[model samples]
Target: MVWGLTPLFVHQRILPVECWYPFDEKRKYVYETLYFIQILAQGQIGQVFGNGSGVYVVLITLICGQYDILFCSLKNVLYTAEINSGVSAELLRGKQLAVDKEKEELNQYFVSKETFENLDNLDQRLVKRNLRNATKDALNECIRHHQGIVKVCTLLEEFYNPFCLVKSLQMTVQLCFLVFVSVNTTASVLKSLNLAQYLFMTLCELFIFTYLGQVLKVQSLKTADALFRCDWYLLDLDIRKNLLIFLPIAIRPVQMTSAKFSGMDTQRLRAILTQAFSFFTLLQSLT
Candidate 1:
């Protein structure tokens, strides 16, 4: 039952989908469908178990099942909200870039065509001053939009902390449960199955699934972080040039120190490296 529900929960929470319909309409459909399914499944499971005296157990199970569905729905809603917020940030960034580009193009057009060259000295100076003022105004507008993007990014980061904490806690609890079950199962089956073989198989399966989950979580977080970090404000020429020179050197020590502090746990270190490299590589590739 848990295994079946886990995938459904993850799918609902993590899968990105476009909702073209009205929000209330889509939400109503989701709520109705999930509730109906939950009712049907709980009835079937209880009937199959044939344990009528286990009314309290059945009620608890039903409640938990419904709670999980609700949790998944909430997660989906939050995910969509974050994406929409990030899209607003992207729009602001794009608008700022467009304004800057337009100003640059206008300045270049005037300069290359020598539109002010034929004018008297005073006239040329006046034209140049007007162009500068216009450029300044455009830059100010861009800055305003960029500030909006920054605020959205900060909010997204704050939102993600709670989500990541919840996911990590869920994973930890699941891991502990698996360990307890495996240990108890192995002990009970010692007479029928070889102890070494049973333990090895169980441990292998646990490690595989846990590692896969960690990988998925790391990838998702890295993608979201990269999206949030996508700001034109960091693309100043001086900063970009210096970042290239400093990044390799800066990242190496941080990676090494994190690994050492982690007691050389290769799995954990590899996960860290994956996230670090992903961010750095994204920054480098964005030019």
Candidate 2:
């Protein structure tokens, strides 16, 4: 039930084009940085390991580190949006003030003294009433816009919490697995020679690989979510300014799918599964 509903929520509503950032130089910076960090971490781990198992451990470490970076990037984008919204509100207020001044000035130029006083009093009252109404309307509009952004951010944050919980569980399971592997490896080494050195190596391998795998998984989700959200936001704001960039980013996923799940029914099921599995797999894999 949770699986079926979540995807419908995400794909049909939450995961729309309006939720992403515009694909531009800013986005490119984030993408490049995430890619570079992932690669560099992986490369370093690869160079440090000598055996196949040890190398695998390093690969996992790199993956986990990459995920950390992704989470951080998404967090940054959320913060940026919050800051931008505040700035936009201030700008709107300034524009309203300028408009009000022009309206007052135009009224002053057209009327004579005594007649103007009565007219002025009546006009002043009307202007005040209208200004109050306008201010309330503007405030409401800003609140609505800000509320939508906040809703998405809150949802993303909720999504992240489960990922963290899953990662912790996975780490605990991996540690137990490593201990079992280490005991077996130690027993074999003790029969032939001293076990201290081999035991240390086994422990190190277990820790590094387990940490790496967990981090990588976390980062992948983070990066993908950030990219998705950023593009959605940009597309929502001004499609014309960013449509060319947004369309490619938005449509790329649809293009990548095989024909098997291309039909409406299949696609619907796939989306449901995708959301359910995304939530489930992240948790299960960690466990």
Candidate 3:
């Protein structure tokens, strides 16, 4: 904003933006009128993009947070499996360790630890059953949360598709124009500074979108890893089966698209910059 209004303090008569005016702007009244009009237009455009992008960033951040929370839930589901039973994870781990040590000493233990514990009247089946049930419930909840995340992403893509598409389409041209103007020797120092600021702001806006999208994609892909690390092997057949079924779905990362054409990620920024540079070269060659 400060850059947009820097012309007011400069000695030379320069408008905030370089555009063809309908009337001659040399007259005092005409210059002042157009100056304020340009400032007003710039402010309005800034307000629209600022508010809209702020909301869009907030939503994406929230989804990333949800993914973080879901990961924690999955990793802890095994440790927290105490549904309808007094058996704690600490006790379960202790029992397993003791049985393992005893089997090593005997050197003739062929049966699984749980079976041996059951023979010892430790009620291992009851604990295993409770753990299995708790794991099943937690898996179901995680599946629901995953579904919700996918649904919200789909809705966001639909709602912001047009806005993102327009911004992406114009970014190359905007960058080229800003770069050309800022580097032009004939342009005033203040105007060049303003164009530089605008160029940085535009790049920052695009970075926010692509960076957030990358974060979302990376976090979503980590869900499968979280599931694997949650000790699924210790779970019963049904619970392990559930994890197997979910693994494939979780492996496929979520993505956001602009107008369902371009994927939103850091790569998009690179592609856009490449196109802008190519066009800028052509423009320079033409002149």
Q: Considering every candidate listed, which one attains the maximal lDDT? A: 3
**Cα-based TM-score, every candidate:** 0.25, 0.24, 0.80
Runs in model 1 with CA error above 4 Å? Answer: 1-129, 179-287
User: Model 2: how far is 143 from its true place, Å?
Assistant: 28
- Put down candidate 1 lDDT per residue, 88-132, tens digits, no spaces: 444434543554433432321111221111222322233232323
lDDT of each: 0.35, 0.37, 0.75
List residue ranges in candidate 2 displaced over 4 A.
Answer: 1-193, 227-287
* lDDT for position 136 in model 2: 34
Model 3, residue 76: C-alpha shift (Å): 1.6
lDDT tens digits, residue span 92-115, model 2: 445435544333422221112111
Candidate with the larger TM-score of 2 and 3: 3
How many pairs collide in each candidate, listed in order? 0, 21, 0
lDDT of 3 by residue, 178-268 (tens): 7776655576666677777888998999888878777778878878877876777788887788888888999998877778888888888
**Candidates sorted on lDDT, descending:** 3, 2, 1
| Alpha-carbon RMSD of each model | 22.4, 25.1, 9.6
lDDT for 58 in candidate 1 is 38
